[model samples]
Target: MQTRSKTSSLLSAKAAAAASPATTPRPPLKPKPFLQLNKHATTPLPIQEMNWRMERLTPPPPAAAVAKVALARNSPDAPKVEASPLERRRPAAATVRSKQELPKNPPVNWEYVYDEIKLFRRMNSAPVDTLGCGILASPTLPPKVFRFQTFTALLLSSQTKDPANAAAIERLKTQLPGGLTIESVLEVDVKTLQSLLRGVSFHMKKAVYLKGAAQILVDQFDSDVPKEANEILKLPGIGPKMAHLAMQFCWGINDSGIGVDTHFHRIANKLGWVHTKEYDHEATRKELQQWLPVKYWAEINPLFVGFGQVHCTADHPLCHKCPVSDMCPKKDFKPRK
Candidate 1:
């Protein structure tokens, strides 16, 4: 009975242990590696394992040591590294040159130069004196027609030599039905206008501009060219130079501004009458207007243009023959012997 009773108690204890929660500890799970290696590795060891071995073999320098080295390298006492030849030859950033300040008083004797130029122009007749845009139109045309013809001539004169510009004007005068009038320009097709302007530069484009300008004139200015500079500029292909010239030739008004073409721009700079860093005609015009007398404004264009055409030419100027050669500074000019 005692043995049976002990066996029964053992059985009861086993049942109780089975019903309770488990007490045995489980083994820890392995953590995933931070880096992954490719399966296509040819080395005996995985790439990640090789990296780990290298890291263990040579540890990084201490943070304090790194800071000290950086400080020493950046110190003023440290020697600078010499640049290589290519590095030394590298172009530096480009700097913009500012506009030059013009002198308060004339740099040279402008009046003397002016008189010499007038005398030189009178002695030698230039293409501008005869075939220029201002005189190209026939005097027989009515006042309004004459004005329109003068404006047309100026438009045709852009980037074209006086002879070619004159030829184109003659073609328009003869070929067009109404003789270069605003109505004739409107009536003629663009192809016909382009053909008439064959010798002129950018003839096709100028032809288009002519047609457009004529249409605008009919719509706005009572079929006549605008008298004011601002209104004249409203037309296509007309700039300040053309506008000022038109005002002078058409309306006999010269106080608007100087008609600064390439010749005028070049002569003014060479004479030291105006100081400009570049070939900026507008800047030259403004500088000339500031100091030049108003009475000479009307005559300067023709005088300088003729002078440039005859003596002070673009290439190999005849400085020996120049009237004011002794007084001239001859800026940026090497005269012919």
Candidate 2:
């Protein structure tokens, strides 16, 4: 009877607690400690201790200490030292080369050279007959016939003395009634023409070339010279220099090409305007045209030829009296007085 009474009292107490509105709250959880990725040891350090150690991490050695370490290392014991932050970073000055280290052929002040040519030309007499110059000096012929004459003069002039070339041209004139013309040259027997051109350099080959070139002109362009550069280049014994000379002197075309003869080539190389060991005129002509302005073309050949003949001769140039000696590089050249 007593046990049944106790059970009934316990049930009544549980019911009273279940009916109550207020209850106890749960405790807050603690945050997990962070582990560093760089930590390598098996036993992990506590968060506070690890953070404290990170704050006091070792910094890079001072410059003096680095120097001492580098000095200590020698021979096979020399360690490959890593570059410092400053050293590893690119230097600001590296982007541009120093003025002293720049290419040897500095930009040419062409105007200065142009001024020199102008001054020299004004003071000097007319240049000696280079075949092209001689042809240009002739009394103007009819346009229809002048091209052939100018071209032939250029062909006959190569390696021939100026007097010899002039004499040969005079002989050719005697062969033809009017003047040296396409029909006149072609009509003359090759052997007769060769004999007339006796004093000229390579007369035999040149005579044959002259006849063949005139024949081509008559057949291709009706005895007229073609104004186009490509067409002019197609003729026998005609190169860029000769064709261009004809264009300028005969056809009144200017600055279309540069005529580099032996004198011009030698003088240009000496001036440091061109750098080449080649003794060929054709090669020098191509190289010089790269830097030489078209406006200067009219003056260059004349100035060089005149200077070469009078002052800057092949074997012994008169450097002491040369007008532009102060400005000339005089490369590979030693002047006599």
Candidate 3:
């Protein structure tokens, strides 16, 4: 009976304890020192803990010694390495050449040269002075006929000396029925014309040119030479030199251009009036027209031609006796003994 009473009392005390609630609360848990959080975790970490973790995990900067060495290498006052012999001997980069500048003013005083030439021409008379194609035409012919004769003389003068050309013109004037007029040149057969032009250079070829030119003149220009320089150039055997000369002598137009022949070309280059390649008369003419005064155009051709014939002869220029010797550059000239 005593054992039964003790067991009943113990059972009653356990039931009463199970029914009662605890008053005291449990403390919060501390995280482990080495614990790592998952990178894809849903839970957010505190700001201070996240900052500490970032600081410990980041890569460090370059070493101070390495940075100082790099800075020294790039410094301006650092010693330079010497180039090899081959590197030093290597050709420099090719530089572009600047375009040649056109001269604003002529090199020499042209008025002084012109005056000297005029003086020299007064003492010496060249074949061109009397026997030139300009004067070879007959004064007895009609105005239109006279111009035609002048044109014919110029055609014959090419590659032939003045004396020979004058003789040829005289023969044509006396031999041909109409005396070198457009009708006479057209009427004469090529062979007969060739025979008449015996002393002229390329007489046979010139005969064909004369006949063709006469036909063109009759058909196009009404048997008269064209006044325009461009129209005159359309004729056979007539070049820029002949066209310009015709304008000056035939039409009395002086400002057309400077009629540059071999003599004028050589002297112009020798005097340093123009810079052009040898035998480049066209370039010489352009350069002269660019700088030369318009007032001197009419007389320059005759003046230079006469000077070239006497003192400034092509093969042997008389440099010692030249009136403008002091002013002349005498380009490419060798002192003759």
Q: Give the Cα-based TM-score of candidate 2 against the true structure.
A: 0.63
| Winning model by lDDT | 1
Cα lDDT tens digits for candidate 3, 70-110: 35556898666553442232211110001112343554355
lDDT of 2 at 31: 62
Indicate the TM-score of model 1.
0.68
What stretches of model 1 exceed 4 Å from their correct place? Answer: 1-102, 335-337
- For candidate 3, the 10 contiguous residues with the lowest summed lDDT are 91-100
**When superposed on Cα atoms, how far off is each prediction in RMSD?**
28.9, 29.9, 36.9
Off by over 4 Å in 2: 1-110, 126-140, 335-337
Model 1: lDDT equals 0.76
Model 2 lDDT tens row, 229-320: 67888888877777777777667776678877778888876765666665777777777777666776755777777667656778878777
* Per-candidate TM-score against the hidden true structure: 0.68, 0.63, 0.67
Q: Please list the C-alpha lDDT of all candidates, in the order they appear.
A: 0.76, 0.66, 0.76
> What residue pairs are clashing in model 3?
none
Distance from true position, residue 327, model 3, in Å?
1.4
Model 1 over residues 91-147: C-alpha lDDT tens digits?
111100111134546443455457656655544667898899999987888988999
Between 1 and 2, whose TM-score is larger? 1
